[model samples]
Target: MPKVKRKTKAKSKGGIFSRFRDYISQYMTAAAAGVTVVAIGLAALFWAGGYFGLLGEQVSRMTNAGAVAMGMDVRRVTAKGLDNTQRNDILDAVGPVIGSSIFHFDPHAARARVENLGWVRVAAVSRLWPNSVHVSIRERRPAAVWQMSGTLHLIDENGVVIAEEISDAEYTNLPLIVGAGAPATANEILRALRKEPALWGAATALVRVGDRRWNMRLQKGGDVKFPETDISNAVRDLARLHDAYGILDRELEYVDLRDPENLIYREAGADETIAG
Candidate 1:
């Protein structure tokens, strides 16, 4: 053979090195983008942290700045519908954010604290924006002054005791309820009495007799016994009788309306008398 004229096939080196360089370039570009993103994030974090304070303080400052930009600083806190609750109580519930931004102030949290107050039944707290916080409250009206264990309690219509150790002068207009379990049925009896406005006005106290029926003490004097069943109708009947004949004005000890067929009465000093 003529000097073994077989030539080895040349391996193409350009394709391999080109592919390798392209892969390195792609990795470099990705790394550069990742580094740029991290740098931007760090710069933002540092700016917020250094200009403000720690994380919490930083967030607070930013929030206050935004609120100030929008003109939401709390300058006045106005509360309405306050009768029995003290001003300091409400102010204490609102916390110490008087001069701070109202946007960051939590209305819901402030409302809960106000609702916990003894006189507040339903409280509505809202931001007035730009300079004020408004609190509207619905106070619990005293439905009855309940006497338990020789202590009087101011109770709402729902039988919830609003306050204890309150002076009688504070709740002189409320009806007095006496005996155990009287608070639970006080509203019902009072509502029934309302059907007869004259009777309702003339009533002074309600006593739960035997935990079954009610005995109403009149402003004039004496007591009116009401039956357990159809108590409302029984009260109406007594009112009609009082209107027709000045029966309640008479010197009677007790007027029994328990029996629908007949009424029983007793003279102030006499034993017992029955009327039909």
Candidate 2:
């Protein structure tokens, strides 16, 4: 009789309530997984039946309507960096976004449409809080006027056509490039001519010959035939010749600088070629 020390048993920690909670948790977890699978199957069925797009569109419309009801509709659109690009063009590119819900407006599509314009080099479109949309853009800088097929087009530094059918009086200071491939190759010769201010000032237009070489139409009334290669050196030599012997000042029919070592010219009324 040791006072009956082992007579009583210890109670279980957490008792029956803990076990009940665990059982309920497992049951609910399995039910939730079953529901998720059913939802996934329904979604796949909708996709296979070609109703997914329509369902998504309906959901989007509902969401947009709800947002508009909450005063999230676009009321004003602001634009920046719109020098050469017309305001109307920007508005058209963004579509009828003003009366629509700001949350439903697609900025990427608007940007793409804006960038499709000839003058817009790059564009950005975005929503501004609850009731505004914003647009930003950078425009191409015109480098020259290209003349082809009896039409005039404005071109940028990279020879990308900015605008077509331009008037003759517009941008009179920009150099005119002639022939089919002239715009693509005008930068090299134009840059070389720029180094020789006198030559650049005398130049009326640059003509691409056979898409290989260039011939400069001079303001003084003659043409200068340039070699296909070593254009910079040839231009420098012509500038030197002009400075030394007044070669460009004379009344000449044409100047041929195709040969690096020879300078040939023909007088306005002479048939013979003169070498200097």
Candidate 3:
């Protein structure tokens, strides 16, 4: 007699996680996605409430209205350097105190307008209570008059060109630095001279040469050459010679310090010669 065939149960291949793991993982992932959505919604709600209005235009209107209610009479507006016409321009950019709230005023724009004065390197602005506006300024200290591209312009220590129209009378004492990136180059030359009081007083112009060489021109038009290698030694050696012989007191063309073995110079009224 034929008996009824019985079905056998299949064995799991990937441990206990083979069957229900997929559904469980899918549910957990869906839950994590839901949490992220909620977090984003809350952040957006806060940003909108702060910058915009929590309840439509009501909050915005209140904030702006509070500032408007404190408008000033503008009895006095004071700014420095009115002679350069920058004061008026800056004041115009800042607007008047009357019927205006300092909260809405743009100090950054006012600063920019003041900087257009050419001499003003930086500017500070403040609101002086209800009736007046106060402003302070910092002018750029000219480091040198740079000769670039066949034209000369006044420059600050940071290589920023200050003005093209600075009269010599206003900055006659400024150094004359020539060649590319002379402002940065001058810093090193000036630093070296600062170590010796004699050179500090007599060093005038710094002339760049050969892209890697520097020449220090004294107040009397005597040039001191520094080779790219061991340049400091050259300067020290020259300074020592100058201290010993008082070479600067005589007529000379230049002092070639680049050669350590021998020092050469051109007599002020005579030909070039080697000095021990």
Q: Write candidate 1's Cα lDDT for 84-183 as tens digits.
A: 8888899899888776888789999999999998789999999886689888999998898998778898999988888987776777877889999998
lDDT of 1 at 6: 84
lDDT digits (tens) for residues 37-156 of candidate 3: 998999898887684455656755565567666654345567774444455666665666555555555567767776766667777777776656676777777777877666678877
Provide TM-scores for the models.
0.68, 0.81, 0.59
Clashes of each: 0, 0, 2
Alpha carbon lDDT at 31, candidate 3: 100
What RMSD does model 1 have? 6.4
Candidate lDDT (C-alpha), each: 0.85, 0.92, 0.71
lDDT of 1 at 42: 90
Candidate 1 Cα lDDT to native: 0.85
Q: Over the stretch 1-276, how does candidate 2's per-residue lDDT look in tens digits?
A: 567556677798778999999999999999999999999999899899989899889999999899899999999989999898899999999999887899889999999999999999998899989899899999999999999988999999889999989999999999999998888888888888888999878888999899999999988788999999999999999999999988888888999999988999997999799998
Ranking by TM-score: 2, 1, 3
Error of 3 at 178 (Å): 2.1
